[model samples]
Target: MFISLNVKFDLFYSILAPNVIPDGFVDGRQVTEKLLEATQLDKNLYQCGNTKVFFKAGTLAHLEDLRDDKLNGIISLFQAEIRGYLMRKQYKKLQDQRVALTLMQRNIRKYLVLRNWPWWRLYTKVKPMLNIARQEEEMKKAAEELAKLKEEFEKLEKLKKELEEQNVTVLQQKNDLFLQLQTEQDSLADAEEKISKLVLQRGDMEQRIKELEERLADEEDQAANLNEVKKKMSSEIEELKKDVEDLESSLQKAEQEKQTKDNQIRTLQAEMAQQDETIGKLNKDKKNLEEQNKRTQEALQAEEDKVNHLNKLKAKLESTLDEVSLWTKWIFFNIFHSLL
Candidate 1:
């Protein structure tokens, strides 16, 4: 987000009054603060150059890396968005200064015309000159005001960049969440397979225990031996049940993780949808601003034509005023000589 205030200051001063040039430095920091005041943007969010302000400089540069990743024009969109915003800011600042300068010129012309009044009292004649001086002061004030406005314009521009970057950041987060959800789902599927195998093993153990019980019932004469066999089988059955329990616990944990992932995915989806809405609104605003810029350009061009006409008229008036002063001075000289 960079703004360039490239006014021809030298030409401006020469046109206003050849011998007078206003002295001041363009306080980039003060201008930046003023531009961001309404937006409440932090100073760290941007950097100010002599005529340019850059926003999210590092982030913007990082985005260029996406060009080879086939992310499909998103990076370009961000660039164009910022560029358009800068252009709009520039146009607005120019429009404001143009209006102020036009008004000032008109006021100066009024003073000049009044100063030419041939029958006015000495005090009355002096008053117009004083007013002219005052108007010059007002012109200086107007320049200062223009600088403030330029900064204010930057505030809006900074907000625009922040909003767009936020949308991009949200999208990146959503993609990461989606990948996590996929991994959780795959883990859940593996857990389900392990649980199915455990259930089949438990069924096999139950069948073996039933067979051992029938054998012991049929061989009471070898009751001690059968008792030993039943004890051994029971131990094996207990071990299988423990294995099944562990598998069940593992399955439950996997299911819990899957549920958590699903919840996160849903939440991120909601945020992405909201961001989409915001981006849409911003796109609309961009269109409106473009239209406004077109109109402003046309208006500015018309104003330039009017200013040229006025300047030509002013030149002729100044020439006539110079001739009138010479005639007045010559007549006074002749009268003084006659009296002597």
Candidate 2:
């Protein structure tokens, strides 16, 4: 077919080779590599000449030259080419056009069925709503996760507060235990001092009892000597006999006083024995307290509940010690009264 000297042969070549023109009758001769090369060369030459036409090198834009040609001449040449091709094909082009038209109609029907156009139009209309629903679901899941994290954080904070309270309670308990221990130690010291005083009092009472015994022995010796003197003077004179009788009465009185003193000594010994028993009991109690103190020291590192129990035990022990101290004092007073 005839073509304009300046037609975009390269454009036809580039498009037809990629099958973009669909049913166009393009062939190897019309879209040759040589034709494309010539078209690119002409564009570059025209560009170098600085012509008024705007065309890119290495492309079919060289066809801009056809725009300067007479419009009637182009139409006449295009018609002549069409008439020559149609004369040779007779009605074959029409038949081919009819077939192509039928194929296009069938393809259009298949596309409509496959795409489901009515449903596609509905989908296009509701797509934003579906997207919004999906976004809402994602937002809900994120909110749930955030809430769960916040709950966990609150639990951790509560646990931290509980631990702080426990720490404060433990410190308070430790201080209380320290004060109680100091008080108990002071009480123990006082008890020991009292016990020492009791021991000194016991020694003084024993010494006094020894001196009284010695005096009683000396009085007995003097009474024996007077009895010998009375025997010697018995038949000497009535004066001497009267004198002996007086001395005998005095001796009898001295014997009665010695017996009374002996009774008092026995009573004092009994009181001393009671004092010893009391001291022994006190010593036992002190030992028990020492053991309990040792246990308390051992349990210093134990739990608060155990420390509280120990505190109660200490109070009971203190009460018992106070009772024991009162008993000891009463016993000491009675012993001293008897000695006096």
TM-score of the candidate numbered 2?
0.27
* RMSD of candidates 1 onward, in order: 21.1, 63.4
For model 1, residues 1-340, the per-residue Cα lDDT tens digits are: 4444333223321322323332332233443445344334566776665444566866334323432333446578888999999999999999999999999999899878777676543445334443444545554655555555556555656665666676577667655644554454456456556757756775776677567657655665556667777677667766766765775677577567657756765665566566566657766675665555555555555545555555565465556556657776998999999999
Clashes of each: 6, 0
- The TM-score measured for candidate 1 stands at 0.42
The 10 consecutive residues of candidate 2 with the worst lDDT sum are 46-55
lDDT of 1: 0.57
Q: Give one digit per residue, the lDDT tens place, for model 2 in 1-340.
A: 1233223344544432343332322332334434444434553333221111223553333344433343556689999999999887978888899999999999999877767676775454444443444545654655555555556555555555555555555545544543443344345445445545545554564565456556556666778766555444333334434544555555555555545545554554454455455545555555655555555444433434444554565465556556656766897999999999
